[model samples]
Target: MELDFSNIKVVGFDADDTLWVNETYFREAEEKFAALLENYETKNKVDQELFKMEMNNLELYGYGIKGFMLSMIESAMELSNNNVPPETITEILNLGKEMITRPVELLQGVEEVLQKLARKYRLIVLTKGDLLDQERKLERSGLTRYFHHVEVLSDKKEENYKNLLDHLEIKTNEFLMIGNSLKSDVLPIMNIGAKAVHVPFHTTWAHEHIAPEEHDNSHLTLNTLSEILKYLE
Candidate 1:
């Protein structure tokens, strides 16, 4: 179905997987870390333990680097039988930092699409992550110039969506959110009567991918970001 975005004045986007590469880098680091831990424990055991720790930490730390670092620390300590050397722990921390500091590689056509959309809509970047890390990514991505506002959110719940809409002084129906995650990017905005377009990424993190039951009533799902141009045109 084509979107009637003629009423849309503010176009909010989810930054991480939507605009650039995010979870794939983290997944690579995780696989490497699992390999390193194989020396201390079976890969299956280590993975199971790490999953538990990550789920627990997500409740406290939410998502992003902090939760990932905590998961790494717990995994290392568990696999080493609580005898993990300071050097090994430092190595893990360094790896986590490197993952965050890695250069941003924008998805194909992201720059061109943003450049085109910026001319027609008020663009805003709404992402959840460590502030400094997100800022570094935006700086490196070279697409930051097109956004009118950049929001670093702790959570992408209904309240956050409402707050952003209120701050922009726009009604929910007047905004459109384009993002990769159905859970974070599409559902919340749709709940508030805003339109949403889902642009599925090739590889989504376990946490970011949501099941069909979570689909928004007022949203459209697409296989690629470029599909949105069809609606806009």
Candidate 2:
């Protein structure tokens, strides 16, 4: 879908996979965790158990480092007969902290595209993650100056998007959401009568990916963020 930026005011973006490298770090941490748990359970069993814990926690805690840390601790305790060493738990917690504080790596063309778009639109970052972690990444990326508003949300739902639009005093048709996750970024915005552009990332966490049936209307998918430039032109 072509976007005519002549009248568009606000452009919202997802932070993690949309602007920088995120999933790869999480995947690396998960592999290290699996290695640690291998002594107690088989790799496949550990993965399944961890997934189950994460799914359950999503309902209770939603998504973020807090939920992730809880899931890791719970999975370790469950798989190890409640005998997980304190030192090992400390190690995992340290690893999670490291993942959050690691240097930011902006995705290809992200800086360039953001720089270009900032000149024309009121850019806002709407990301869901641990508050401090998300803020740290934005500060480190040096892209914070390009955005007029930064929203670190607990979850990306239709109501959240609607509220953001209301708070900004922008109509649904005047806003466009750009991000990686179809389920979190695209579907919710589309559901509220806004336009969404999905910039597909190479790696996605299991929880981030969505089934095709969920994508219905007012959504466009692109392999690269740079493709947005062509449409806007």
Candidate 3:
């Protein structure tokens, strides 16, 4: 079914993977982490356990590199039966630091899409992660000038989006969200009477994956951020 965006006045963009590179770094870090613990567990097992650890600690730690770092440390301890070297723990800390300090790499056509859309729509960023990390990326992105507001959310659940839209006085009908994660960005926004566009990135975290049957084909899914121009611009 073809959906209408004619009434959409506010365009929300997801920061990680949508506008800039993110998941790829996490993948790379996971590889390094697996290698660090290869002696204690297979890479596959290490990856699985780490994801479980992150989920277990999500409520306590929230979402961010810090939480991921702690999860890695804990996973390493469990996988190694608490025999993992202290140096391995230090390496995990360094991995998180490296991710935080890495320069933001904007995805293809991000700036052009933002610039064009900003002219006619209220463009804002609605992303969930470490607040400071997101802010740092936005500042380094050099695209901050195009956005009217920047929000770093704790999570992207339906209520979170609803609350933010209400707080910003943006009517649900007038809001449109674009992002990489179908679970976080597309489904929840669509559920809350808002429009959503899925612009998939090359890599997705395991936690963000959803079964194909879970989504209906009502919303738009673009191959790249620039393709959105045909609909909105």
Number of the top lDDT candidate: 3
Could you say which candidate leads in TM-score? 3
Q: Tell me the tens digit of each residue's lDDT in model 1 across 1-233.
A: 65688888888888888999998887787777787777798877877788788888886877787678889898899789898888778878887888877889888778877888889988899999878888888999998899999999888999988987898787898899999888888888888899889888888877776776766345788777777777774
User: Worst ten-residue run, lDDT, model 1?
Assistant: 209-218
TM-score of each: 0.93, 0.94, 0.97
List pairs with backbone clashes in candidate 3.
none
**What RMSD value applies to candidate 3?**
1.0
Supply candidate 2's per-residue lDDT for 30. 81
Question: All candidates: CA RMSD in angstroms?
Answer: 1.7, 1.6, 1.0
TM-score-sorted candidate list, best first: 3, 2, 1
Worst 10 residues of 3 by lDDT: 1-10
Reference-based lDDT, residue 44, model 1: 76
The digit string of per-residue lDDT tens for model 3 on 163-217 reads 9999999999999999999999999999999999999898988899999999987
Report lDDT per candidate. 0.84, 0.86, 0.94
Give the distance in Å from residue 83's predicted Cα in candidate 2 to where it truly belongs: 1.4
Regarding TM-score, does 2 or 3 come out ahead?
Answer: 3
